[model samples]
Target chain A: MNSQPPAASTETSYGEAIRAGFVHLLSSHREVFAIGQGLWSPWYVGNSMTDLDKLFGKARVIDTPVSELACTGAAVGAALCGYRPIVIHPRMDFMVLAADQIINQAAKWHHMLGGQAIAPVTIRAIINRGGEQGAQHSQALHAWFAHIPGLRVVMPSSVADARDLLVASVLCDDPVLYIDDRWLYERKAVLPAVSERPLAAEGPRVVRSGTDITLVGAGYSSWLCEQAAEILAAEGLDAEVIDVRVLNPFDPAVILASVSRTGRLCVVDGGWRNAGWAGEVIASVAEALDPRQLKSSPRRITLPNAPAPTSRMLEADYYIDAGHVAAAARTMLAARETAS
Target chain B: MSHRHWQSELAGLADPAQYTAPLVIEAAQGTRLMGLLRSMLVIRHTEDQIGQLVVAGLARTPCHLGIGQEAVAVGVATQLRTTDRVFGNHRSHAHFLALGGTPTSLIAEVLGKASGTSRGMGGSMHLFGREFGFHGSVPIVGATIPIATGAALAAKLDGGDSVAVAFFGDGATEEGVFHESMNLAAVHDLPVLFVCENNLFSSHLDIELRQPSDRISRYAEAHRVRSLTVDGNDLLAVEAAANALITGIRQGAGPALLEAVTYRFRGHVGPNEDIDVGVHRRMADVSAWKRRCPIKRLSEGLLAAGIVSGDELAALEREVVAKITDAVTLARRADYPDPSALHDLVYACRP
Candidate 1:
């Protein structure tokens, strides 16, 4: 944890920053088009597509019918034919309907066709959770998209990344799955300007530096780690927070280096507990670090392997937040204390 | 209940040799009948050579032969230019040759040579030749229908008269992408031509068992798109249907569907036509269908129209045979790719 208190930033939330990013992207590239259902209506409140259809007209900001498979396939086809299309799946669960086009066609075209084509399309699939919505609506399926080889999966944890990563994903010359979590939309932070160009390829960034423990988080989980870092700081327990923005081409050098120093790690993610993206990160650190490097065993804070419940209390207990992350770090510290 | 109606409506097209009447070309000069004849002949000879390779154990891949259905490809390809995008499915040998793809490259691809269309990575099922405007082909049925629609949308965005064509089988119509693509094309008024080759059987299972009807144009009609069902064996009919559709598509009228009723001469895959797994195709049906060969029909038409005599037809066959023989020899001699190149073509050359 830092010696000084964190500085106060602007009041713009991640959702607002993301919407401005869309306006910038649409105005920047004439070939770029954003197509999905309910984009122009209030149903897409945090969609970052406010007034895009009016500004760019219906042709550019295409309002498609309720067809995920056809629309996703159309985006892939459009990308192949020299168009940069950002296809939005307002809810990530419905993206399963388009698995054929996403996994088989969009992801495989470049490699299977022997580089004869480039599907430079960006799929903006949102992970909406925390509500009383039932099983169908509240699921984080980023791990499945990360499992594919030809795709670049990015989970933005901060408002800056939400803006910059969208810009980067659209500019990338390959199929990119830009996974956004709705929980982080209300979190406010300083973001890049709409016209500012960010790095095309960014690795994991160490947001908060510490030495006692290395806390890893992806998307909303990264924000959770930041909150946990504050709690750990109050207890005089220094904890390092690393935001894993890119999941597919994950370079664990930073995590391994932090683990080598801290000798303990806690992975926080919004995915299933068993066989999740957090597990992959934890396993990588365990494999890369020596056995003696760890003062205590690694820990993972993820959702239980069950469908989301409709009750408010059940929803509260199911999701992992800042308090859960801090508790996980404390448990690791207690175990090390007991052993010592 | 609709099943019975579908059966009666499709009963007229159930026979394999429904339109086996030999074509007698009346006037061949102004219509470019000679080029059409040559194109069909090339496709027939190409598939024939591929069958020989599969039987000789030289081609080590699934060679889906469209031996009896060459006219469907040649007809559609005749009306297409180098800029018009076209996609094909597993049974795409005739589609490749008809689009002016050289025999040497295609045969080399089948033989897994380094100089093949996919650089030996995609055997016979996956083919890619952008120069000739055959964008790409995959083994997955109906996979390219939406992709072709995307290409057509791209053409429209580019503000050009170019159109996109998707060549698939009757089996592909059963896939959701086919219907989705038709709807998308119609909604966007994309310049796309959905060409369905209704060969009755979809890999040994008859269309009757799979669908309520044998005709695929009905699906197009459901999408409110213009469609035409033609005798796939007759080159003129297929071309005329495709020409009208392509012209309208170019004029920004919208998407159109052309269902070419044809039959595969050989089994679903490989050389032998007599061997089938389920509901064996009667030998009489196979023989009668062969009598309606696209190449033979065009040849007879050309001969009758005084375009070429019997001796000329025989000489053309000999010439095609010689070219195929040379392509095979070259393909056999072509080198296989180095093992280190396994990961090379997976991505484009990064700039």
Candidate 2:
């Protein structure tokens, strides 16, 4: 788990991690399959859909047309047909064009249809490096889905979590919004033999722990927070780190428990400030906590409310790095001193 | 209920009338009979209003009004129950209302009011009344057909007899999923009724211009499923076909197709039938098609049969108009969904 991209195998950059989980999903469920835009169209721009075409064959691993709306509608079609489909979100932006399918149809069909229709569809969205990709390409917009009721949002930070969540997603009865971080694509680790069912496929999991400030993060930011926590421990502040595997059905009890124990909180999120997932987490922590729980006001470190710049120099200026997260935690602690 | 023939369900795509043109019905009688008429009328008026509403700027969503297409819904839905599932396409007002969904909720939905069928989030095209067994309707043509077919497969797994229905237009036949849905539904012996309202148009392009034959039954025939084509304007015909075929399906007759040939008086979308896309449209054909109005034709037969007098028919019209008016008022007065609720519906609620 370094900055070096893992050797690209016969699989595409995104495919190395996806291959294991998708293969597991296919073998386990007679009804489950992986499908999406480039599913057969030859090029998987963001999804590591390499060798998938070979594994599942053309019928199951379908590559569709440029019609995102039609493609999404087809997913609903496939899903309603008792097929558990892992739908490709191609880009964070493509979903916007197909909102009617996901937001209006697939997401609400079960509840709206009075449980008569269950859309057990999984959407895989990739948030590539949010900084250099500019406005559209760089968004870690799990916050866009942070409020839907019927969806389970899972953003895995490790290879096993990545692989296991895919299998678990296929197994779950509800629809899942599974986000893969392109920034971490080709990043490798030893995957656990992913259980078909583990308790937290759509819930949070603690990656590492400490006793000072609890740092919660998801997807790419989860790894970033880990590095930031290391810097914090070196600074003599023991910050615990929690990987919020899921965003919407967020594990508030676990987060609050950590906050109750540590008596402080700092969140690092890749999505932009204001309306991002970090803001919601901050709100959730604030809403859940009373006067009894804290030694400091909770802090959130995220990309500033500005367009992602293309140049490396501008990215360093715009996006949040480990140094920024460590700085924010210290600032929260320092501000805690004045208030006390 | 014993269906030894166990016919292929999609054959109706080929032989349109075989499944829908039945002159036989048994022991059908009061609120149940009247309920059928009421549903047809409600479909007519609601769609008529939807046309006006779209032009009036009250409803912004694309509205596929099934105005001249009421009998098919009342006919098909009469044979269905709450436990059974039904799905429709862009033209689903009749499908939803006939299945016993509220007019106020539908109107509110068209108006984007909180009390709408989808809680004001999904407009007229995407109606979901899961409690009443109306699963959903999609704007994407033929999208929900396969889903309904799939749901039927699920119901089969659960055992016992429950049928799934997919109500689409002739235009949807062009989509590959329609055939896929039919093939899958038949091959699995899933108990589903594919009801196609062939009004001879895909939006503005007439089916004649788009298709080689005026008939859509051939596709259903190609699939080797049981097929029925009927004058969708005839309620008795629609009802008899649906009733007879539905019992067979529920008795494990497998999949079947009932193609009801009907027309929508309105445009491919919104209220105006000729919303300026006059390319292949003939006002004359629209007029000719209007004469085949399912409601009018039914009333004429009822009147000829002395089912009621002119005064009684007048009274019924008044009641339907009143209901439409009330629905409009309520929908207009109803609130828009909370902007916050926008985020709430996409996922299942969890603690």
Best by DockQ: 1
Candidate 1 collision pairs: none
| Residue B257 miss distance in model 1 (angstroms) | 0.6
By TM-score, who's the top model here?
1
| Alpha-carbon shift of residue B263 in model 1 (angstroms) | 0.4
User: Quality of candidate 1's docking, in CAPRI categories?
Assistant: acceptable
- By summed lDDT, the worst window of 10 consecutive residues in model 1 chain A runs over A1-10
lDDT of model 1, residue A121: 88
Q: What is the C-alpha lDDT of each candidate?
A: 0.83, 0.74
Instruction: For candidate 2, write residues B140-255 as lDDT tens digits.
Output: 77777766765676576557898888888888889776776677667667798888888777877756456667677788789878887777877888888898889989999888
C-alpha TM-scores of all predictions: 0.94, 0.63
- Model 1: how far residue A54 lies from native, Å: 0.3
